[model samples]
Target: MTTVAAPTRRRGLFATLGDIYHERTNFNFIGRSRIWLGVSSLMVAISIGALLLIGLNLGIDFEGGTQWEFSVASGNPSSTQVREALKDTPARDARILTLSNGGVRVQSSELKTADRELVTQALSNYSKVDASAISIVSVGPTWGEQVSQKALIALLFFFILISVYLTFRFEWKMALASIIAVVHDIFITIGVYALTGFEVTPATVVAILTILGFSLYDTVVVFDKIKENQSTLGREKGDSYSSMVNRSMNQVLMRSLNTSFIALLPVISLLVVGSGILGAVTLRDFSLALFVGLLVGAYSSIFVATPILVILKEREPRFRALRDRSGPSVSAVAVESVVLDEENVMPAATPNPNDQRVTPRARQSRRGKRR
Candidate 1:
């Protein structure tokens, strides 16, 4: 007795995860660009709304304040109680937070020496500790305002330099697309923070700047591939500029995913272990900002950047002619039919030989050759 051959359908580990590392997917990024645009627009609108309505919970770094630091030895005071105690003093708008390391941070408006003493006394009474256990950090409003102005200036300069560099490397269309994607990432990240009421601190500002660089890197990767493909192999018959952009994104899809995932792993670990477990608020803030920004940055790079590039490039005389001839309704379908060869990993559009009609002369020639 003999066994039958195993079915070819059975695949190993690499084949199961969408073959993401090995095979290219024919996902029509540009075909579904309208959906992406709609989603991004809606997100941007919601983000803008949150920013307008809720605003960020600015930390002492951004909004000048008087901070009274203390650790509880025995008892605790609720934020409401602390605020009530300070209501009669200059630290009237006191906000209290329980630190992760079993500590208490009392942030408030500027306090006079007398008010400060009153706060210390109140905290001492609440915590059952001596008044000497209090620590104070007072930042002038001028410093906070200056920091804010400097951050804005840095962001502005970053945009200008990035635009110039991208324009030089790729083209104005790609530069525009990348800028739009970066802006989308920024607004989405900021909006999420605003909506969540996360404390916006100097660490958060640093994270945001870092996110800008990460987003630009992702955008440039996609753009670089698109530029190379468009210049080299995009002249194939029945291929549209939109499809080429989509194809380029697919080519480097796994690379972007891997890079983002690798980057996020440590950030997530810091958020969970270093921040949550170890009571590192700075790590929490930085990692949280990075987590949101990296995700949004990846999304905008693939969906927003390439799609906008296609839309912009399609307005050009060459691409306009191509679009007119291919027709929008049918071009995407045509592009989808062109499969990427698995073995060669390149675009294939050779017409089916069987689909060609054999005329009388051709049939005679074939019969003669056969004989």
Candidate 2:
């Protein structure tokens, strides 16, 4: 008997691309892992509960308070000692924080003109402090409330506009998924503030909005790619909508990473260098939120938005058909063989028996002429 050799398997371009796409679909970090989603969601719930109970610690910008920064000689002056020295001042709700350089910063709520003078006089008891170092900044409570309202309005408007635009540009499924991802990033950022007890200010609000915009931009890019792939791959056999979406997401994953890295550079710099050079606490707060939000946004774009979209699109009839057609047993061979002619070649017209039909009058005339 003669021995026969088995044919070696050859991979095609589409097969290689499909393997890459399928490999990305199983990403445990950002893919639809039940364990990760459950853990993250539980943490998010805890953070939300803490936020509800404690709320945000609104800063002078939002609560209408006075803040004074004094640079005293570096002598490890305790916060308690500073507070005690300024106890005689006529400012209520006073707080003293120790600066990195052993200096002191004081913040108080509602001080009169003479009260400011008394604060200055009281600070003289501490180590050599210049009078000009005690500059006071104040705002009225009514103005603070107005600022708070405007911030809320702007956020609401931003969300509404984003939702409408996403829906128009892509689909309602994508819009809903993007908005949910936004909410996820926002809540996590706010929760970090609540858990760490960071002061929320106008600049913080700006940072939050900026993060939302960045997150939405990232999600939109992914969704736009998904939309293109959906239109192009809708008729593909043995490929469900879910698979197409996953493929689209994988294709753009690198682009998302590159974009996020570029955006995070400046934010990280502000967090590190700006904080040290300028001694501006606001930069630290804003950058902290931005950094965390950026990370969460990237994650949410992949896990939250795409998974939710898969769930939503699966509800459609056409998607259901695609899903039914895309069974595990289904092979590329089957897909190609079934749709290859329609896809790569034109269909030949079949002769119709009814096409030979003529009007009754013409048939009757023909019969009479023949007779």
Tell me how far the alpha carbon of residue 30 in candidate 1 is from the true structure, in angstroms, after superposition.
Answer: 0.8
| Cand. 1 TM to true fold | 0.83
Root mean square deviation (Cα) for candidate 2: 15.3
Task: Measure candidate 1: CA RMSD.
Answer: 8.8
lDDT of 1 by residue, 108-172 (tens): 87667787788788777767668887888888798899999999999999999999999999888
RMSD of each: 8.8, 15.3
Task: For candidate 1, list the clashing residue pairs, or say none.
Answer: none
Per-model tally of clashing residue pairs: 0, 0
The model with the greatest lDDT is 1
- Tens-digit lDDT track of model 2 for 138-168: 8878889999999999999999999899988
Q: Local distance difference test, per candidate?
A: 0.80, 0.75
> Scored by Cα lDDT, where does model 1 land?
0.80
Which ten residues in a row are the worst by lDDT in model 1?
Answer: 337-346
